[model samples]
Target: MPSATLRQPPSIPKWGRPKQTTKKLDWAEIKVIDLSTYDEPNGKQKLAEELRDAVHHTGFFSVTGTGLTQEEIERQYDIGQAYFDLPLEEKGDPKYRCDFAKGNYFGYRAANEKKIMGTAVLDNVESLNIPKFIPSNSHEPFPHFLHPFRPEIESFSRRSLDIASKIFTLFSLILELPETYFSDQHRYDDASEDHLRYMMYHPRPAADDAKVQNTWSRAHTDFGSLTLLWSQDVAGLQLKTPAGEWKYVPPVPNGIICNVGDTLSFWSAGYFKSTIHRVIRPPEDQAHIHRLGLFYFVRPGNEVDIKPVASPLLRRLGLVGEDAEEREPVRGLEYVRERVKDYHDHGDYADKKGKKFKVRNLEIEDEAS
Candidate 1:
C-alpha cells in the first residue's frame, strides 16, 4: 500500500515562461520524407539510414505516402470533439477511474488531474481516452465507452495500429534488430499485456486573460519508446533541442508528429532524445480552438529485457556509462502504473529517494512526523 503522508501534489500551475532558445522550425524547409519504400528489401537499407538521421538529429520527423487522407483525419478529429461536448452526465456512465490493471482507457480523465509522466506537473487539459481495439479476456464484451464516437474512433484506431505496426518494423530494421522485436514481445494470445493508445482533448482558456498562461501545459518528456501525435492546427507545440533551444512545431495538414521517448533513448543508448514539449491553451477568444490529438505509444514487448545495445556510435557519443550495468526491463503497463502512482503520491520518489516506498533507501518515516 502507498503511504498516506505523501499523496501526489495537485497539478503544477503554469507560471512565468521558462527560459527557452530562439531556434524555430522553418516548416517550409523542414524535410518530409517518404517511408513507404521500407517494404522493399533494398528500400529498407535506405529507410534505415534516413531513420537514423532523423532520430539522431531532429528527434522528430514526418513521413508521407501511407495514404492517410485528410478527410479521415478530420472525421476522427470531429468525433473526438463530439465526444467531449456530450453533457458531462451523458459521458460519465463509463467513468474510467482507477482500473489501471487493464489499462487506463474507456472514460473521461480530467486534465492536470494526472501527474505528468509521474513526476512533472499535470497539464491543464481534460481527456477522453480510448485505446486501440484490443478485446479483453472476459467472456462478456465490454460495453462501448465513448458511445457517440465509437464507430469513428475505432475506425481511426484500427488504421493507426496498422500504420504503427509498419513503422515499428521500420524502426527495428533501422536499429539493425529483428523486425519482430516489439511485436513478438507483446503477444496477446499468450496473455501478455499489449499495446495501448489514447486520444486527448485540450480545452482553450475561458478568457483572453494572460493569467491563464502559466496554468496550461508544462514542459516535459514522453515516457514510452515512440509517440505518434496528430495535433491541432493552432500553435503551441514546441520542442527543446540538444543545445537547449525550444522550437515550435506548428501543425502540418495530413501529417502527424513523431517523437522519440525516454524508453527509446535508453534502449538505443541515447541515440535519440525524447524531445521535451508542452502545449499552451489558446486565449479566451479562441475558446472554440480547443485541440484534440491522437497519441499512439509504441513500446517494446512486455517480457523483453531492454538494455543499450553496444555500439561504436554510443561509445563516441559518451552515452554508455563506464560502470553501468543492465537493469531489468519493466513491463510497459507496470512501468506506466508505477510512474503514475508515484506521480500521484510524490514528485520525486524514484529519482530523489531511489525507490517508491523507501526514503533514501531507508524505511518510510511514520506518518505522524
Candidate 2:
C-alpha cells in the first residue's frame, strides 16, 4: 500500500482562527481526562457523568470503549487503509454521483467542492461515503462502487451499528427515557434507520492555490441524531469550545469520539448541543502524513418529527417560547439535498429572502476545495 507519507500537503495561510486565543479548548487537559482510568464498576457511571459534562461544556471529547475492543477498532482502520490503497482509477469506477437530498452518499467528493460556512477559503481533502444494507426493494439507485466495498466495509458498518445502539441506550438513560424508547423504534422496516459512514482521506494540499483539498468537513453540524468517529492520531479535528476557541481533539488509545447532531439537539430541547466542527490538515511542517477518519452517524428515521420537548432545562434555556412551536420534521432526503446545494453554492439561501425555513434547512453547496 502506498503510504500517506508519500503525499504531504502544501502550505496555506491559517486564517479564520487567531494564532492564540482565550476561546480555545485546551487539547492537553482534555486528553488527560480522556485517557483517565475508568475500569471499575462505577467507572462506567463516572464515565457517563463526565461524558455528559464534556458534551455540554466542551462539545467534544475522547471516549473509551462502551463495548468495542482496541483490536476491533484497529480492524476497521485497517479496512479503510486497504481501501484507500486501491488505485485512484479503481476507486473512481462508480464515479461520484450525488443527489441533493442524500448528502455525499455514493460519490467521490473533491476538496473545496463543499464550501465552508462563513469562509471564503476552500478545504483540502477528498472523501467517500458508503451506506450500509441498501434496501433491496428500494428504488433509489445505489452506486456500483458501493458493491465491491460492501464486503470489506460491512464489518466496519456492523461495528458502528452495534456501538450506536449501545450509545443510544446510554443517551436514553441520560435523558431519563425508558431503556427501550430509543431501541424499539428500529423494529420497523420503513423506519429510515440509516447507518451512514464516512471514510475521509486527506491528501496534502497542492502547491498551486487552485488545487487544495477540502481540509475537513467545513464548519457544519451533523444532520441526524448522533455520530461516532474514530479519527486518525493526526491533529486536525477542531471543535468550538464553550469560550469560543477551537481546540484540537487529540486521539486517545482505542477511543471513539462522539457528538450529538442537530436533530438530537432539537429533540433534547437544547440540553445537548449540536456543536459545529471543521477539519484542517495539520501544518505542512508537522510530521503526520494523511489524516483519515471513519465516521458512524446515527440519525433519526425520515418521517420522525423534530421539536423541542418540555424540560426544565429547555424552559431555562429559552428553547421553548411562550408558544410551543412544533418544527416540522425534515425528510432525510430533503435535508441531504439542501446540504448538496449549500456545498455547491456556499450556504446562500436558495429560497427567496425573508422566507421561512424549516428544520435541517441547509444551504451549503457541493464543491471540492
Candidate 3:
C-alpha cells in the first residue's frame, strides 16, 4: 500500500541485442507436503520434522490443503489482471508506482526496470508490492480509480499471512523453541517489512529471451524469514542444487510454493538452507505466456535480533559460526535495509565490502569476502 509517483515504465518491446550463451539445465521435481494434517497432535511435530529436512537440504517445498480455495486465489489473479490491463500510464501513476531506487517497494515497478542480475540487460518483469492492510494499517492508498480492488487485496494479503503464521509455528518447533517464538515476532502491528507482491514476466522475443534466460532475474536469495508464492503455470522458476544443477519448480494444483530466506538461514545459524534460485525462459508450450506471479514475503519485527539461535540441533551439526564477532546480531529491519540498498545501488551483494554476511558453509571465511 506504499504509494508514490513512479517513473521508468517497463516497456518490453524496447530491449537490446540478445547475449550469447550455451548452457541449459535439466530440471527435476521438488518436495511437496500436505498441510491438512497440521491439526493432529503428532501432526504438527511430524510436519516440522519433514520441513526441517527440506530446509536443511534444498530450502524449497510445495504445500497443499491451505484451505485457501482456488476460487479465491483466482479471484485475486483476475483482479490483478484487471489492474494490469489498465493503460500503462494509469498502472504506472507516479503517485502509486513504487520507488525502489529510494528503498521503498510499496507500489508498482514497470516491467524491464528491475535488474535482478547485474548483466547490462534489465529484467523483463513488472511487479506491484503491497504491504499488510488492516483497518488501522499504516500505509498509503491506491489511486482513486484503483480503489475498488483494495478490499480484495487486503483480504487476500491477510489470508496469506495466516498461512505464514502457521508456518512460523512449525519453524519455532523445528528450532526447539516455544511455538510462539517466531509468530510473536511477526505480528502485524510492528513487523519489519511484510509484503504481497504481484508480478508479471512479459514474454520476450526468442532472441532476447534466450539472451536473458527467458527472464532476467539472476540467482539470488530472498530478504526475509519466509516467502510464500502462489503457484503459476509458467516454467522458468528454477532452483539450484548443492551439486550446482538447476531444476524447474513447476506449480502443483492447489499448492503454494514456500522457500526459506536469508533471515531464517541466519537465525538458524546456517542449519537451514537459503538456497540460491533464478528464472529462465519458459518451455516451448509456454513460450507465448506472460506469467503472473503472486507472493507473500514475511519478515520479523524491526527490533528482533537476527542472530544465531542457541539450539541443540545446530550445535550437534557443527553449523554454528566459530567467529562470534562476525556473528554479532543485527536488527531485522536494519539487516533488510542494508541488503536491499546494496543490491539496488550496485546490482550485486554487499558482501564484497563492509556489509559482510555469514550464512551456510560458503567459500568465504568467517565473514563474507
Report per-prediction Cα RMSD to one decimal: 10.4, 8.8, 7.0
Best by lDDT: 3
lDDT of 3 by residue, 240-281 (tens): 787878788866888999999888887787777887777777
The TM-score obtained by model 2 is 0.70
TM-score, every prediction: 0.70, 0.70, 0.83
| Model 3 CA deviation exceeding 4 Å by range | 1-25, 114-121, 134-137, 321-327, 346-369
For model 1, residues 209-300, the per-residue Cα lDDT tens digits are 24434335556566556677764455566666666665667565567778776566666676775666655554334434545565666655
What TM-score does model 1 achieve against the real structure? 0.70
Which has the greatest TM-score? 3
Worst 10 residues of 2 by lDDT: 12-21
- 1 or 3, greater by TM-score: 3
- Candidate 2, position 53, lDDT: 68
Give the alpha carbon lDDT tens digit for every residue of 47-95 in model 2.
5566666556555655664566665565555545555556666654544
